[model samples]
Target: MKNIRIVITLMLTLSITISNAGTPKNDKIETPNDSLRLAELNDFWAEVSRTVSEGDFEGYKATYHEDAVVVFTTGENKGSVSIAKALRNWEQDFIDTKSGKTRNSVEFRFSQRVGDETTAHETGIFAFQSNNGTGNDNPKQFVHFNALLIKRAEAWLLVMEYQKSKATEEEWNVLE
Candidate 1:
């Protein structure tokens, strides 16, 4: 009986150790490389915002991957669409902005960001505002969004964009 109990205890201990060895750590400690990569990701998003604000259509297009996909989960247009199709739909807006017919700006605030050296998943709210180059009376439209990006050849390009839903200003303010 004593030998049996010792064997059972040893088996349990070994099993526990093996299980733990395969389990991922819940608490992730940010390393220096992580911080640097995050900074680069921030710069990537800033470039997106800057391109939209300045009506740089070519620059904006460069932010996305060649085979990017966009998932729209709000309103009547709730479906997956190719990035090229979505860009075609928004081409007029870009043209208008570039022609000084409208001024637009987009700002992002993240609630969560997780990623490694080459891939990232960012969840956040984006506030897009547009005016007819008149004044600051344009209402800011906020949307909850999740963006999946991958770094390729020194450039971070969006692979998938999930526009989840419309977000209230209150919800937008809660995230920084």
Candidate 2:
């Protein structure tokens, strides 16, 4: 009976080890030239904000990736909008504002790469401009944006963007 118990334990241990060994690791760390990418993406982000602030939809659309998706945090259309339409709609909204003021601009600070050269995930904070406008009705604009960027030939294009404008203490959970 002792021998049978020992054999069962060994079988269970072996099965567990084999199953773990067969599972693939999700970590695909890559040493990307982050400075170059940052420069490029920063330029694009600036262009987007500038175009929107200046009420130039065409200029805003020119900075977007061909298939990029922008998620608007506040305003009428608060969901995902196409690259072209997003520019038009956002420009119109800004123009219709009380003073046509853009108190703060958003920036993208590349965090890290967890995939191949063709694809990578990045994270950054959406900073708020504290100085500008007429009053204190600025919505406390601060958020975090995560993006999945894809390299197409010689250009890097944004494929997906997820944003969380606010998080409560109860939801501070990140499962690895």
Candidate 3:
């Protein structure tokens, strides 16, 4: 019985060692560079907001990867679409804002962010408000979103944008 117990303990120890060997040592270590990487991501989102607010269509377009995808859940629009198509649909708004026919702004608040040095998944809520120059009521619109980004050629570009659903002001405030 003593010999059997010794064998079992040794087996268990070996198994644990093997398992740990397969795991990356830095998996849970927070390196100083983590904050710097996150700051770069924050700047990426800030540029998105800035381009949209200023109606810089070309600049906004440059934020996306050439083959990016956009997913949405609006009525009659419940699937993934090419970023080019999405941009086409949204171009008129940018043009309107640029021509002074309207004013628009968007802001984002993050709930979670995960990524490595080359990739990122950002989950957040965005508030968009538009004024059509007319006296019509323009309420702020809030949305829950997840954006996947990749670092390419030292520039961060959005690869996939998932506009999940509508978000309330309360939900947006909680992230803050």
Candidate 4:
């Protein structure tokens, strides 16, 4: 019968289609080496953040490239440029921190890991909370942080950086 033949053909086609539908071809297979590298990068990032918040000037300088640059977006130090100047500022800060005149902590909102082992583009936002530690004053600052790091002889170093404050112009004007 013509109808029976048509039904048989339809069933054969359906079975063939179902049999060919397997796992996706694009499923990612992460290797053990990739996992280890990702973990290493994460640990390095955390150590870098910790050094700054703990007022470790030497540790902070060790984390950066020899010829690096820093830009400030907002604050009394707005439009700040020069890595050496930033280092000097941190050096002074470390001294003050010992006297309890200045203390701060940094909280990163995000740190996206991009690129390969030789180079990486990282970005995030952070809030730097500063206080007198004597309970005299308290203030918080938010900045958009960007950095480009390259592996320099096996260690990753930040070669380029940009930082823009999250505070509005009006807020800076009123506070400063």
Candidate 5:
């Protein structure tokens, strides 16, 4: 089962990378709706990313549906942990940095979301750096993100999100 999961993850990473990376002539935004949605999703995601970068856990949590499912493939908190897990993780990470011993940073690249009026799926590349106040600028870890969001009561909320590691930097460079 683990092997299968890894295989599926690899396929998704490859496909998303291919679609977002390089020239991408075949997947251009082809409609007015696409342009509008692209704008909206980008704006909404900007809020989420900002909240994350600032370690605003409550604000970040608000971006997701109450019953959202979030998964981290390369973190210690692995597998189907519900929203509460995120609360815990954020709280702990925040508290861990209380003594001025750490820093958490998030930066996104080449991100885009596409879907219909009530639903959207965003695929992109990002990195979350855990800095221990060292002079080094390298990220301790990073991931490629795939997210699903639903429009509820005219607002968008993430319903499902997945993260994996590697090869997304090139894909991200394709955007900016």
Candidate 6:
């Protein structure tokens, strides 16, 4: 009957429309790999912060790439050491200073990937405290940092970092 044909046509049209609607627009779709990269990067920094605060140098070192490069802002005071050696050097220092409520807080923003989902960059600010807790006379110092991360098999590790202390008075004045 004509009614049957009309019903079939309507059903077909509805199905087509539904399928088309569900399809993504021209906007680039973020693949699952992209999501994993973001989470891995976040977790890497999180563990770094936790390890430093807990005085677990080994745990902190585990987040870095095998051949990672690090540039420190307070190099004179903090001492410059290779990624692998730095962890060992800092381990005793961290433990010695562990009695205080010292803490390190990391805040990073997601960045764009350069080539594929396997590599990306991020930047953020860090707050470091020497006080055992928030109530101490010591204040948290702000430092700016940028990091490069590369995805390895089942892991995303920090390959490099550029770190610096807060801008100087002259630098701040120039910006103003």
Best by TM-score, which number? 1
Candidate 6 per-residue lDDT over residues 99-148, each given as its tens digit = 55454443333323433577877765555656555556365555666778
User: Candidate 5 residues 125-172, lDDT tens each?
Assistant: 776677666856554344777888998987889899887656445566
Candidate 5 wrong stretches, greater than 4 Å: 1-29, 75-77, 95-101, 134-140
Candidate 6, residue 160: how far the Cα is off, in Å: 1.1
**Model 3 quality (TM-score):** 0.83
* Angstrom error at residue 109, model 3: 0.8
lDDT of each: 0.92, 0.57, 0.91, 0.69, 0.73, 0.65
Error of 5 at 111 (Å): 6.5
Off by over 4 Å in 4: 1-37, 76-80, 167-176
Worst 10-residue lDDT window for candidate 3 reads: 25-34
Q: Please state the error at residue 26 of candidate 2 in Å.
A: 11
Candidate rank order under TM-score: 1, 3, 5, 4, 6, 2
Clashing pairs in 4: none
Give the winner by TM-score: 4 or 5.
Answer: 5
lDDT of 4 at 73: 69
Could you tell me which 10 consecutive residues in candidate 2 have the lowest summed lDDT? 167-176
Better of 5 and 6 by TM-score: 5
Instruction: Give the distance in Å from residue 125's predicted Cα in candidate 6 to where it truly belongs.
Output: 1.5
Model 2 spans with C-alpha error above 4 angstroms: 1-39, 42-57, 72-78, 93-104, 110-118, 130-140, 167-176
Q: lDDT tens string, model 3, 15-117? A: 9999899898756766767787888988988999998888999999999999999999844679999999999999999998898888899999998888989
Could you give candidate 4's per-residue lDDT for residues 50-147 as a string of tens digits? Answer: 87567777777887888888877656776745677778767877666655677767655444556676777777776677776677546666677777
Report clash pairs, candidate 5: none
What would the per-residue lDDT of candidate 2 be over residues 107-141, giving only the tens digit for each residue? 34434434454565766555443325565545435
Q: Write the per-residue lDDT of candidate 1 for residues 1-176, one digit (tens) a residue.
A: 99999999999999999988977887677998889889999899899999898888989999999999999997789999999999998887888888988999999999988988999999999999999768664899899999999999999999999999999999999998
